[model samples]
Target: MKTYTCQCGTPLFFGNRQCVECGLDAGWCDVCSETAAVSPEGTCVSCGTSVVPCANRTTYDVCNCFVDASLAEPGTLCRSCGMTTMVPDTSLPANVRRWALLEAAKRRLLYDFRTVGYPDDQLTALPPLAFRFLSDTPDKHVVTGHANGVITINTSEADPVHRESTRQQFGEPHRTLIGHMRHETGHFFWMREIEGRRDAEATRLFGDADANPYAETMKQYYEQGPPEDWNEQFISTYAASHPWEDFAETYAFYLDMRAVLDTLRWNAPEQVQDLGDDLPSMLATYCSAGIVLNEINRTMGLTDLVPEVVPPAVVSKLQFVHDVFESLRTGVVSQS
Candidate 1:
């Protein structure tokens, strides 16, 4: 994402709630499509428009985006917070922090999702898109997944200790709350754009999701593990478990590429100056930038920022993903 400027001429960031230099409040002005200073009464300093700060700021301190004043009521939610249908029980202080972390990740995920031009309207049984942040209970165990347009994420993933342990258990190079959000939304969009719309093409590209028995596939995957040559054809080993997973995994990779490209454009324009819509150019530029980014992380003694290598077969799956996003951009769905 591009940097924003405060009224004080200090640089602001996507997650900034207040300008550190001037102490003036900062908010995401949806109308202006950038973070800007907002008055105490919720006036946009940049555009001189009226907006409503999301209630999550006052109630939970988890949001910084402003809602359009015209569409807002007494306690209106911003576009990002409004989609969160449920959150963890916040009576406990720990739960509140966990909810905060998940909300931050969700906002980032939705920001990138809408940035890619997908509409917020629902194409499934669930009204628009909803999220459920939950913790495991003795009677009801919650696994992170999507169904009928609703995405459920285990609240435990918010804690670094828990997330890193789970990542190592799965032998994942990287696992993150935003990664969970993107991967689950991939399933959400598959239901929206491809389940019945382009099943034939998706089957040819991945496999027949309907033909594969999902539960049995999951069971067998754990027992036998992924094929020894999984990396040759899949973006991740878990992606080789099922066709739906393959699509979601490849779709997540597509989002990761677009996000990195978007970041490079704003923060390092010279690197991606000639990048265009072509897949080859995108892959070339992305891999090129990844090498530099990964090395930078190594210098800091951190995990490689971008670990997965997009292989030839995975490229085919990503081609399918790109087509879906393009269709959404050009066809029925309009950007907000």
Candidate 2:
């Protein structure tokens, strides 16, 4: 999440469609992890060619990466982008707008995965990752749930009011579209992290993977309340419901730290001008940055953006997860 500057020197964001200062098209090149000047012939560094459309500018309704076009037929969709197991039916009058927003969010999520040096190719290869955006039916599909390997997002998420209501209903102070993306991607990563590695130690730390994740294990607990000591053992109350939820919450917590760290670097480039990949040092830098960030938020009379503090034990766990991600990139652990 390092900052990007347009050719005109204006800052750019990963999802920016245009450079406000220069009137030029802006796009994220997965290979370089930076916003690049995109022309018709522009290509992503990861893919080495323009295989997809500019993710930033999707008016043509195609991938921005341009990697798919080079790997497949002229009009072929990128294998990664084509991994949409399901999309909301745009023909439905009410869904047309929501579906577009979801697509934009999905592309951003995929881009983040790539920016962090994980391959979408490997993720797609696993049971062929797919997504479904559906209209919620009280007796039918749940608003948000993961089954098998597919992720189902509720179309209602597009409505700000509905999302806010759900946040209040759940007693969550911070919830947003991107937060939803981080949480759901955690589920996808759980499959990668736990598959075939379920030893006693791993099981003890995470849980017995054999348990049914969807069953009402926490039915009684919800009726009563989360364990009185939830903060001691669980990442969040939602995580206390199931082992699978715990993993997802932990994974999301890792993503949150990485994102916040990136934001810190972006806000104070001079401070981290020559940073390295050492996790502990980076975390220390973020610790300092967090203090300043929270103080600034307080000055504005805003609540802390990141309220949860990662305890020492959790910090160690997060470092391990980051190592796992690094290993995956180096072929030490094949994401496949």
Candidate 3:
């Protein structure tokens, strides 16, 4: 979430398609790993490199990311937009808006992935990561989940009223477009980084992902509901459904903590300046910041900004995630 310098020295943000101060076109440069002013003629103003604007930006006014022009082929998308193999039918105006929201959240997720030093395309063995947005029709209902690296999101989840209603229906403390993106992405990463390679350790922390059939576990979970002490052991009631969910939920929370800590680093440097000893430093910073954020939300009569409690067990699971990403970042573990 760190702001970048526009070509005109204005502050550039992730979603900027045009610099507000200078009126120059702006987009994220994949090579520079920053959002900056770029000409519509396919030139990065900041880096002096040729880059192609994402087609979605021009056609639908949805994207603000660019692809390196030298590497881009006909119809090539930017890093984030490229992963999307399907988008909801854009003929409907509502579907277009949903796609916009999903793309915005996705950019944040991809930014976090890059910030954590994940390799862009290193997992050759696993199915390629992709996103598919689908809208529910009369005969078919699209479920939001992940399989074989494909993350499907129901367009209805992007509607504010629908999302809030569903949140209350599920008894979730917090839910939103980014939350859904982060959560389903958790499933994809588990398949990519942990499935067979680190299952033993992951199981030790979050239980066995293969202990029971996922369908059966999910069916039983909705039928019986989470345990009374679910909050003590898991981040959310839904997380208590199964171990894969446990891992995905924990991973999603880990992403949330990292993203928040990044903002904290900018606003209150003293609070999250150093990620000393990794997870412990992060936890300490998060606990300190969450207390203030939660109180501020309470004062405003808003939902708690950081509602999920970081219990001892949850911290252990988060520690495993930190280690996994750290290993990726430092090349301490072989991705291949």
Model 2: per-residue lDDT, tens digit, 104-155?
6777666567546776566767575677878866587656766566788888
lDDT (Cα atoms) of all candidates against the true structure:
0.85, 0.64, 0.85
Off by over 4 Å in 1: 122-127, 332-336
RMSD of each predicted structure: 2.7, 4.1, 2.4
Ordered list by TM-score, greatest first: 1, 3, 2
Q: Clashing pairs in model 1? A: none
> Which prediction has more favorable TM-score, 1 or 3?
1
User: How many pairs of residues collide in model 3?
Assistant: 0
In angstroms, how far off is 315's CA in candidate 2? 3.0
* Local accuracy of candidate 1 as per-residue lDDT tens digits, 87-111: 8778888888998888888888877
The order of the candidates by lDDT, greatest first, is 1, 3, 2
Flag regions of model 2 displaced more than 4 Å.
29-34, 40-80, 92-94, 137-139, 209-214, 271-279, 333-336
Query: What value of lDDT does candidate 3 attain over all alpha carbons?
Result: 0.85
RMSD of 2: 4.1
Q: Pick the candidate with the highest TM-score.
A: 1
lDDT (C-alpha) at residue 231 in model 3:
81
